[model samples]
Target: MKRTDIDANVLIAAFQGEGEVCQRALRVLDDPDRKFVVSDYLRLEVLPKPTFHKKREEIEFMQAVFERAEHLDTSPTLTGRAYYGLEI
Candidate 1:
């Protein structure tokens, strides 16, 4: 299985985008070989605003993704090494 970490924008697009963009996003999300690893950062980025505004459908969609995915605890050191090439 391929371990994958989806971006917030891609998740949003899957939920709300149109045409090819939406199709591609959904395809990635639904791939059987994928094992999604998600972080609280992604939840924070995608969930609160929709929940606060009472967008129930959108919230449910995001929650469904969260439910099917593996939750990962992100650390500043790991993020720094991954994204910034920092020796930590």
Candidate 2:
């Protein structure tokens, strides 16, 4: 099986439901050939705002993904390299 990391946009799209983009996002998540990988950064990116606003359904959706997917820690060095293209 291939391990795939889902971006915050994709997770948001999936939670949103309906439309072509949502359909596509669901397809990627539902693919049995792939294993989902999630990072602490992803949780921070998607969870905090919804949680603060009390978007219960959205929070639940994000929580479900975090619970089921393989968790990976986000390091400062890796984040700098990934986001800013800096060697850290």
Candidate 3:
């Protein structure tokens, strides 16, 4: 599907360099075949906070990536509750 499901932390660390995990993810993302899969849920997870004060440009770039990537339906229900209208 030319898609990869990446964790929110990886995305955050790639730009902010908060941990080694982020460094590794950036290396993995260098492969031309990889594309991060996105959804409203992922957006909800990552886009809420500013990682730093002056990185709006970086944030906007990341937002553009999420905006253009393939989207997926989130888990329909978690435990017994529906999340994003999809069953977990």
Candidate 4:
């Protein structure tokens, strides 16, 4: 299967250890034939957890995901529009 873009909500659900969602995420991750694509913005949004103790494991797991997944760079035009309302 081609690489897929995993959304933030799915990551959140997996991190929170929701049984079904975690299982689903695991299935995807376990598929050797599949390529996973993740955006750098998504990584930045999900990596930081305010509650340190609860988030440590999640952060570790996400770091592992990052190691395995392809990260899509946010273009300057996109970043500028998102953060500074500047149209490129």
Number of the top-ranking candidate, with TM-score as the measure: 1
Positional deviation of 65 in candidate 1, in angstroms?
0.5
- Residue 1, model 1: Cα distance from true site in angstroms: 0.6
Tens-place lDDT digits, model 4, residues 1-88: 7787877776676767567878887777778887789875776567645233466677777778878888888786765455452111
**Backbone clashes in model 2, listed as residue pairs:** none
| Model 2 TM-score, all chains together | 0.78
lDDT of each: 0.85, 0.81, 0.65, 0.69
Model 3: lDDT to the true structure? 0.65
Query: What is the TM-score (0 to 1) of candidate 4?
Result: 0.67
Clashing pairs in 4: none
Model 2 alpha-carbon drift over 4 Å, by segment: 75-88
Better of 1 and 3 by lDDT: 1
How many angstroms is residue 62 displaced in model 2 relative to the true structure, after the best TM-score fit? 0.7
The sequence of per-residue lDDT tens digits that candidate 3 reaches over residues 1-88 is: 3678877777777776756776786886666788778776776566545533445766685687687577887665542252333321
Candidate 3 runs further than 4 Å off? 18-20, 51-55, 74-88
- Each prediction's TM-score versus the true structure: 0.81, 0.78, 0.62, 0.67
The candidate that achieves the highest lDDT relative to the unseen native structure:
1
Q: How far out, in Å, is residue 7 in model 2?
A: 0.3
Q: How many backbone clashes does candidate 4 have?
A: 0
> What would you estimate as the lDDT of candidate 1?
0.85
